[model samples]
Target: MSNMEDEYDFSHPERGVAVIINNEAFSTPGQEESDDRAGSSHDAEALDTMFSGLGFEVHRYDNLTSSAMVETLTAIADMEIHSKSDCFACAILSHGGDDVIPDNTPGAVLLERQDYVLGVDSGVVLVASMISIFSDTRCPGLEGKPRLFFFQACRGTNMDPGVGVKVRKTKVNPDVGPPREGDGAEQTDHKDAEEGNVDIEDSNVETNYDSDIDNTDSIPLRPVLSVSPSNINKDILVMYATPPGFYAWRRDTGAWFTQSLRTILTPYNATYWSLTTLLTHVNKRVAVWYESSYPGDTSMNEKKQVPCITHMLTKDVYFRPKNMKHSTLV
Candidate 1:
């Protein structure tokens, strides 16, 4: 267990706000209702229950357009309640892909790619642009407080064929540990051969539009105060549904990442585990316990996914017990 002083103080009267953005329908100019995401509501409801049980004020938004997404997030960042809260969290579930740009080098034919999430209207919003709204210079109320962002969307259309692992049978002994080397053991591939249907967050037909249509440019600018830019990005954590250029899977139940997250961060578990520890457990659950079973598509069958987590948190974070009374810890 970590010392109390090492953990971010979660004892403030307000635990914090948790914003959930669930985009299930798409109605872009050329898109059909068939492009809508299914089962995203399950994720939203699970997140709401989990965060609300953790004492957070949960606010859920559904089917927002690109401009509405930016507006909603910007308003949350400007909320005065943040000044009295201990942390902040936001989760976005929608279709996502890479933002491609023409390489400008002379005679270059390659394209540059950046990560972005799509709004219901199929508008593009860079992931970086969303994080910038909560920078220390912009959202002063959240300075020095942990800010968590969770994205459940595909980064691209690539499928992951998991690597093979060697399995060995050996005698068990109390003092003996697992072998470090394979020792020429036969390798076995683990794949889910069951017949089932799964959905990828990527669109079947790529939508084309002017790159200048990105809605991030229209984000309302806040007054820039004289804060050190050095730590503008401090105390932030971002978790993506999948690695770059990989697909995120969903089913009738919910998204794999979100279901695993909800399972691992139960109210009881939150009391004993640090937030990072919980997330690691979530990573393992999603990576090992789940796999695509779309037998109809051979290429997508048995595919695997691993979530990506990046953080700049300076200290450990712990969620307070539900029944605990509030008191300033620092």
Candidate 2:
């Protein structure tokens, strides 16, 4: 692991960019708010503060429609500034679900919604399509740079039924424990991140300008081959608020996952821990936070959640601020 860390350059690139797509209110005009997402803004603000403290230039988009989200991402992908940057961090905070799509024929298969996070304008946009625009094949400037994605949304409707434990309240220490060190190499799909964006469709937004072409007219077909390995987007990290097929817990103050993240990434803590170690701590903290808010239903009272992370990074990652020592304690 030490040898692996020695192989890469950790010099600060020109300027890193952090993009925050924050969706707070999810209702359009004439419709009641389907979801208020009470604490998303808190998450976004924390993320912005953290990334900015790490020297990233933050770009935030709030309450965007699905089409608007696509347009925004597309515009970012088309920008030529990535080469001048060292890394990119994207945080998406919104209402998400795996809504079922009914087949046209009866008794046919019901399809699960893929790659979309719900937009405020009641539109569903393909998250894959949006991110693919930044793929190495499409956006060459970002090649080899570390890309980070943080998603704070429910992956599904299923809730965890936590096992009963003896009730005992103790006076716990207010300070965080000393950070731990661990070596586990591998990256997550961020592909799931691509599949989680959902929004509504607007027929009025679609328009076509076309003319018939001659039958004799032929365009040469070219076959393109990919050199990269399958299911891998190298040098990227994806952190989800919850695992697939689970609900992400939240409070009026903010989401449990984001709060845990902020706590772990504090300057004092980050100086002593690697990103992987910090994330593991976050997962544990979130998993142990059992919710008991049901008024009369004990079955619904015990709920738990854990965060999911996918990374393709081949080197150690640290989040120390500028002028801080790069030598990691791990």
Candidate 3:
């Protein structure tokens, strides 16, 4: 067998592909954009450090639109790993509103088109689901393999009252409006790759549905795969940043939820621990860390968001590689 295929762990193998998406560029995307965009660089850095330590072959993409993300994810899923690889993992860092985020550039695209409500690349979930489908029939051995997705973006609209602790990444941003059609190009041309670069005005954005939607129906955009998480056999372990109708905390240090995942998966793969065990560690760490440090922050304190494990998986999984290198997170 080829070396690449030989590396894929269908049963108990070595190495895994780690896809990390960093939506916020800090200075590039800027702070004034949204509450979640702030400190995203820190989250990305943490993921990079953790995953690198664990010996994962990490691939990264940043500031992508719903369509661009679809292309990237499709390419990843289309890849044919060897019969030996056990699983795959992905980390998404972005400003998510009900499973989707506006295209990061926020230039001329405008809010209407920007509100694609995508989960896969918007924050984390959408990408995970796309990856999971590949393991379904295309990869017979991966039928029951583990697919881990870690999300650092907020899941709700509530804001954290985290105070006193100064985060360095937060900065000033100007309110920008969505660019008019053909603002950057010709007026006759409507939708094209160039139109993808339009400016968006999200400050005046409105919600078309209920505010307290559950994660099960969290995804906003119409996805290509219609299967619910309950039906899939591929084990998908989703570590959400917060509970339904609750906002996940992003500290000056970093996002509380993703940081916890990083801690659990760092230095080496969590091969010894099952999906449940790893999430347990994540749940405890984020809750404790935020409450203790922030102290008296009623909004964020005491918010111990549980890791929502949708049972599509048929087997146990450890996020990182087993014996190849030190444990890490991403």
- Which candidate wins on TM-score? 1
What TM-score would candidate 3 get against the native? 0.57
- Alpha carbon deviation, residue 254, candidate 2 (Å): 1.0
**Judged by lDDT against the true structure, how good is candidate 2?**
0.60
Expressed as tens digits, the lDDT of each residue in 82-184 for candidate 2 is 8777677787777764444444577866443443476776566554455566678877878877777777876665667754443334211222445345211
For model 3, residues 140-190, the per-residue Cα lDDT tens digits are 544555666666654445433422333333221211123344333211121
Local distance difference test, each candidate: 0.70, 0.60, 0.48
- Scored against the true structure, residue 278 in model 2 reaches a CA lDDT of 76
> lDDT per residue, candidate 1, 1-330, as tens digits?
578678888767798999999998774566443666767898899899888978899999999998999999999988989999999999999888664556689998766656778888778888888989988898998888999999998776777877544334221111111233542221112122211112223333211222111010011112122211112277999988887666788865577788777766766566666788888777776775566656356677667788888889988987867456434322
RMSD of each: 12.1, 15.8, 17.8
Full candidate order by TM-score, most accurate first: 1, 2, 3
Worst 10 residues of 3 by lDDT: 186-195
Instruction: Name model 1 segments beyond 4 Å from true.
Output: 27-33, 101-113, 166-232, 322-330
Name the candidate, 1 or 3, with the larger TM-score value.
Answer: 1
Could you give me the TM-score of model 2 versus the true structure?
Answer: 0.71
Worst 10 residues of 2 by lDDT: 212-221
